[model samples]
Target chain A: SAVISQKPSRDICQRGTSLTIQCQVDSQVTMMFWYRQQPGQSLTLIATANQGSEATYESGFVIDKFPISRPNLTFSTLTVSNMSPEDSSIYLCSVVFGTGGYEQYFGPGTRLTVT
Target chain B: AQSVAQPEDQVNVAEGNPLTVKCTYSVSGNPYLFWYVQYPNRGLQFLLKYITGDNLVKGSYGFEAEFNKSQTSFHLKKPSALVSDSALYFCAHSNDYKLSFGAGTTVTVRA
Candidate 1:
C-alpha cells in the first residue's frame, strides 16, 4: 500500500488556459500513470510517466496536449495544455510500488472544471 | 489487447444480505485481476487481487473474490452487505505494467 496525494484538489480554469497537476507519493514507486475520468464515466489512461524521459501515451492522447514529467521516482506532473470545456474531468495519478507491481494505488484526484 | 468488463452499471441490495459485483476480463496471457472501491470524493482503494494459486482470495473489509479462469470471471463478494459499503467499484486487469479498467459498477446497499 502507498500514500499518494495530488495538488489543487479542485480547480476552475478558463478555456485556453493550461493546468498542471502534481502527484506526490510517500514512497518511491516503480511506475506512475496519469488517467482521466469524465463526468459519471470510466477512467481512461492518458500516459505513463517514465523517469527522466517522455511519457508513453495511450491511443487518442498526444504529448502536445498532455505532457508529463517525472523527475524522480516519488514525484510526477501532468499538464493539460490549451484546455477546453471538453477537457473538464477528474485527473488521477496512480502508482505501482515495490516488486509485485500488480496492484496500483491512486491519489484523491484533481477535479478540473474548464469554463 | 487486455480489457475488462463490468456488466452492471448499478447494483442494489439490502443491508445484511449477501452481495456480488460481476466482472470479466480478457488477456493474452495469465491475468492479474484486481478490484478497487471508490467512495465519493475519495481515491480508489484496492480491495483484492488474484495473481495466481488461489481460487478464492480474501481482502480488506471482509470482501472476497473468486477467480474462475474457465468463465473468465472474477466476481467480488461480501457475506453481509453494510450501508457504508455502498460505493463505486472497478474491475481491472494488468498487462505490461499498464492497467485496463472496466466502466465501473455503483453498488447501493440499503438499510
Candidate 2:
C-alpha cells in the first residue's frame, strides 16, 4: 500500500484558465499515472508520468491539453491547459506499488470545476 | 484491447442482507482483475485483486471477490450489507502496466 496525496483538493477555475495539480507519494514509486473521472462516468487514463522523461499519454489525450511532469520518483504534476466546461472533472493520481506491482493506490483526487 | 464491464448501474440492498456486484472482463491471455470503492467526495480505495493462484480473494471492509475463468467474471460479494457501504464501485483489469476500468456501479444500502 502507498500513501498518495494531491494538492488543490477542489478548485473552481474560469474557462480558458490553466490549472496544475500536484501529486506526492510517500514512498518512491516507479509508475505514476493520471486519471480523469467525469461526472457520473468511469475513470479514463490521461497519461503515465515517467521520471525525467515525457509522460506517455493514452488515446484521446494529448500533451498540449494535459501536460504531465515527473521530476522524480516521488512527485509529479498534471496541468490542464486552456480548460473548458467539458474539462470539469475529478482528476486522480495513482501509483503502482507493492512487490509484484499488482495493485494501484489512488490519491484523494482533485475536483476541478471549470466555470 | 483489455476492458471490463459492469452490468448493473445501481444495486440496492437492505442492511444485514447479502450484497453482490457483478463484473466481467475481456483480455488476451491471463487477466489481472481488481475492485475498488469510492465514497462521496473521496478518492478510490482498493478493495481486492486477483493476479493468480486464487479463486476467491478477500479484501478491506469485509469485501471479497471470486474470479471465475470459464465465466470470465470477477464478482464482489459481502455477507452483510451496511449503510456505510453505500458508494460507487469499480471493476478494472491491468494490461501492460495500465488499467482499464469498467463503468462504476452505485450501491445503496438502506437501513
Candidate 3:
C-alpha cells in the first residue's frame, strides 16, 4: 500500500479566490488522479496526472477551472481557479501502486469551503 | 461505457451480525472490481478487490467480497460487524486505466 498525504487539510476561502492543493506520495507511482466529492455526493474523477505531460481531465472539468501539475512521479498539484460557492467540496488525490498497480489508494483529502 | 451500481443507499446492521453491501456492474470486458470505505471526514480506504482467480477475496479490516460473474456482481461482506465499521462504502469498476465508482452506500453498524 502507498502512503499519501495532502496539504491544507481544511480551508475556508472567499469566492473568486484560488487555492492550490498539493499531493505527495511516499513511493513513486505512474498513475495519479484527482477527484472531487460534493456534499453528500459520489466521487467524480477530475483528471489523470501524467508525470511529464498535461493532465487528462474528464468531461465537465477543464484545465482552466482546475489546472494540474505533475512535476514528477511522487508529487502533483491541483489548483482550483476562480472558485465559487459551488466549488466547495472535498478534493482527493489518489495513486495506483503495487503489483499490477490496479488497486487505487487515496489521500486524506482537502476539504475546501468557498464562502 | 463502464459503470458500477451500488443498489443500496444505506445498510444498517447490528454489531456482531453479518453485513453485506450489494454492487453490480456493466462493462464491455472482464471487470476489475473494488470496494473502498470512507470514515467521517476522511478519504476512501481500500478494502478489497477482485481482479481474477478467486471468487471470494478477503481484505483489510476483516472484509471480503464475492465476485459473481454470472450476476455481474461483486458484493462486499463481513462475517461480523463492528460499530467502528460504520462508514460510507463505495463499489468501483475499472476498465483500461479509467475507474468508475458507484454512488456509494452508507453503512451504519449499531452496537
> Quick one: best DockQ, which candidate?
2
Off by over 4 Å in 2: none
TM-score of each model, paired residue for residue: 0.98, 0.98, 0.97
* Best lDDT among the predictions, by candidate number: 2
Which candidate, 1 or 2, has the higher DockQ? 2
lDDT tens digits by residue: candidate 1, A1-115: 5689999899999999999999999899999999999999988889999999999999999999999999999999999999999999999999998767478889999999999
Error of 2 at A93 (Å): 0.4
Ranking by lDDT: 2, 1, 3
In model 3, state the lDDT of residue A60.
99
- Candidate 1 backbone collisions, by pair: none
lDDT of each residue in A1-115, candidate 3, tens digit only: 5689999899999999999999999998869999999999999999999888899989999999999999998999999999999999999999987448598889999999999
Pick out the ten consecutive residues of candidate 2 chain B with the lowest summed lDDT. Answer: B92-101
C-alpha lDDT of residue B69 in model 3: 88
Q: Write the per-residue lDDT of candidate 3 for residues B37-102, one digit (tens) a residue.
A: 999987899899888898999999999999998999999999999999999999998766567899
Tell me the whole-model lDDT of each prediction, alpha carbons only.
0.94, 0.94, 0.92
Candidate 2 colliding pairs, count: 0
User: Which has the better TM-score: candidate 2, or candidate 3?
Assistant: 2
Worst 10 residues of 2 chain A by lDDT: A96-105
Query: What TM-score does candidate 2 get on C-alpha atoms?
Result: 0.98
Q: Is candidate 2 or candidate 3 better by lDDT?
A: 2
